[model samples]
Target: MGDVVRAPWDAYFVTGFDTCSEVLRGRNWLAPDFAWQERQDDPERWGAVATQEMTKTLSRLNAPEHTCQRRSLGNLFDRSTIQRLTPVIEEHSARLLDDLAEKLRWGEADFVSTVSEQLPISTIGSWLGVPAADHPHILEITHNQVYAQELLPTKSELATSAEATGHLRAYFTEMVRQRRAKPGNDILTGWIHHWDAREPDRETADEILYRLTMFVTIASLETTATLLSAMVGLLLGEPGRWAWLRENPGHIDAAVDEVLRYDPPIQINTRVAAEDTVLAGVPIAKDSMVHVLYGAANHDPRRTENPDAFDIERRGTHLTFGGGVHYCLGAALARLEARTLLIQLLERFPTLRVTTPPVYASRLVFRRVTSMGVSI
Candidate 1:
C-alpha cells in the first residue's frame, strides 16, 4: 500500500509512516468526538450506549474542552510519578510472578490470566487506591467495555460494551460518593479535591470525578496488559530470545520499543478532517473520516529497514503511543511496568518457556493475547 488510499467503506486510509505521522500530528485533523458524531447522517449508528459513554472521555474531546479537562491531571505520568510508581510496579510484578512460578512448576500456566491481565490492574489499582478485592471485576468489565472501541464492533459486542459501561459507571459513581464522604490520600481523592476546588456544584464535581476515575482505570488497564503479554510472547515466541534478554539486561528498554513497534496494542485511530486538506497529494474533504494505521506505519520499510524483522537492538521511533496532544498519558507508566516485569520475570524464572503459541483475540484495533501457556 502507498501513503494514502481510499477504502470502499468511504474512509481514507493512511498507511505510510510519514503520512500517518502527519495525520496524527496535524491540527487540521480531529478525533471523531460527540460533536462529530452528531454531524453524521446515521444517528442510530452514533447513538449506541458505548458511543455515548466514549464521548464523555477525555480522549474524545476537542481542544478547549480537551485542554481544560486534560489540565485537571497535571503530570499524571511524568518521570517523577513513574519513578515513584516503579516500586509499585515491581511489587505487583513480583507477586504475580511468584504465583505464576508455582503454577508453572505444577503444569502450564496461562500468562495472560496469571500475570499479564493481573499486573496492570494491580499497579493502577494500587495507585488509585481501589480496593484489591475489586480488581477482578474491574478488569472483566474493562475488557467488555473495550469492544465498542474496536475497529468494527458487531451488534452483540456493542450491547456487551454498553452493559460493561453501565457497570463501570455504577461502580465508579459509588466510589466517588464514598471518597467524598470520607477522604483518603489516594489519587482518586486528590482528583475529587482538585475538581471540587474548580467546580462550585458538588454533584457536578462528583460526576467529573467519577468519569475521571473510570477513564483512568479503563484507559490504563487493557492496553498495558496487552503490552505485557505481547512483550513476553515475543521474547518467548522464539528460542533463546528470553535467555538473551536475561543475559543482556541493559537492552530492556530496546526490547520494549521493539515489542511496541512489532505489535502495538492499539493499531488504528480514526481522525476526521477539521478542514478541507490535501494528504499525500489526495484531496480530503472536510469532516471526512481518515483511518490512520499506526501498525502499518510502524512497519513501513521506507522508514524502518527490514520492517518485518524483530530486532531488539534497533533504535527507532514508533506511533504506538500515538502523537501530538492526544498521545497516551500512561506511556511512561506502561513502559515502567513492562521493564520492571521483564526484569523480575527473567531473574525469577530462567527456565520459563512458552508451552504453546499465543492465542489472540480476533480484533483489529486492540491486539489482545487471550491466552499464552508457559511452563518452567
Candidate 2:
C-alpha cells in the first residue's frame, strides 16, 4: 500500500507511519462523529442504534464537544491519581496471581481468564467504585458493544452491539441514580460532582456522568487485558525470557513498552476529512473517511529498525494508545497496571510456560485474546 490507499468500499486507508501520524494530528481530520455519519450515503448503516450511541463517546466527538467532555474528567488520570492507585493495583495483581497459581497447581490454567481478564477490570472497577460482583456482567456487555467499533461489522454484530449498548445505558443510569442519592469517594462520584457544578439540569448532569462512566469502563477493560496477556505470552513464549525478566526486574518498563509496540491492542482508528486536504501529495475531499492503521504504522520499517522483531531493549514509540487529542486518557493507568502485574507475575511464576497458542477473536480494530493456556 502507498501512503494512502483507496479501499474497494470507497474508504481511504493510511498505512505509513508518517502519514498516519500526519492525519491523526492534522486539525482538518475529524473522528466519525454523528454529523459525519449523517452525511454518509448509507442511512441505514449510519442510523443504527449502535452507531448513534458511539457518537456520544469521547473517542468520537470533535472540537468543542470533545474538548468540553474531555475537560470534565481532566483530573481523572492525573499523576496524583495514578500514584494513589499504585498500591491498589499491586494488591489486585497479587491476589489475582495467587488465584492463577492455585489453578496451575492442578493442571494448565488459562491466563486470559484467570488473570488477564480479572486484573484490569478489578483495578478499574475498584477505582470507579463498581461492585466486584458486577465485573463479569459489565465485561460481557462491553465485549458485545465493542463489535460496533470494528473496522467492518456485519448487521448481526451491529444488532448485538445495539442490545449491549441499551443494557449498558440502563445499568449505568441506575448506578448514576444510586451514586447521586448516596455519593462516595470514587471517581464516578467525582464525575457526578464535576458535571453537577456545570450543568443546571440534574437529568442532563446524570446523563453526562453516565456516558463518562461507560466510556471509562469500556476503554479500560478489554484492551488492557489483551495487553497483559500479550506481554506474558510473548515473554513466556521465548525460552529464558521470563527468567531473564525475573533476574532483571528493572527492565519491566521496557518490556511492557516493547509489547505495546509489537502487539498493540487497537489496530486501526477511523477519522474523516474535516476539509479538503492533500496527504502524502494525494488530494482528499472533505467528508471522506480515512482508516489509520495503527498496527501497520507500528511495524513500518522506515520508523523502526527490524520492526517485526520483539526486543525489550528497543525504546521506539508506538501508536497503540493512539496519538494527538484522542490519545488514550488511561494510558498511565494501563502502564502502571501492566508493570505492577508483570513484576509480581515474574516473581511468582518464573517457570510459567505457554502450553498452547493464544486464541484471538476475529476482529480488525481491537485485538482480543480470548484464551491462552499456560502451565507451571
Candidate 1 off by > 4 Å: none
Candidate 2 lDDT: 0.90
How do all models score by TM-score?
Answer: 0.98, 0.98
Per-residue CA lDDT of model 2 for 166-251, tens digit only, reads: 99999989999999999998878888888888999998888888888888899999899999999988998788888888888888
Worst 10 residues of 2 by lDDT: 38-47
Clash-forming residue pairs, model 1: none
User: In model 1, what is the error at residue 295, expressed in angstroms?
Assistant: 0.8
C-alpha lDDT values of all predictions: 0.89, 0.90
Off by over 4 Å in 2: none
Q: Count the backbone clashes (under 3 Å) in each candidate.
A: 0, 0
* Weakest lDDT window of 10 consecutive positions for candidate 1: 38-47
Question: Looking at candidate 1, what is the lDDT of residue 72?
Answer: 93
The Cα error of candidate 2 at residue 36, in Å, is 0.9
lDDT per residue as tens, model 1, 107-224: 9999999999999899988888788999989989998998888766888999999999999999999999987889988888888888989999998888788878899899898899
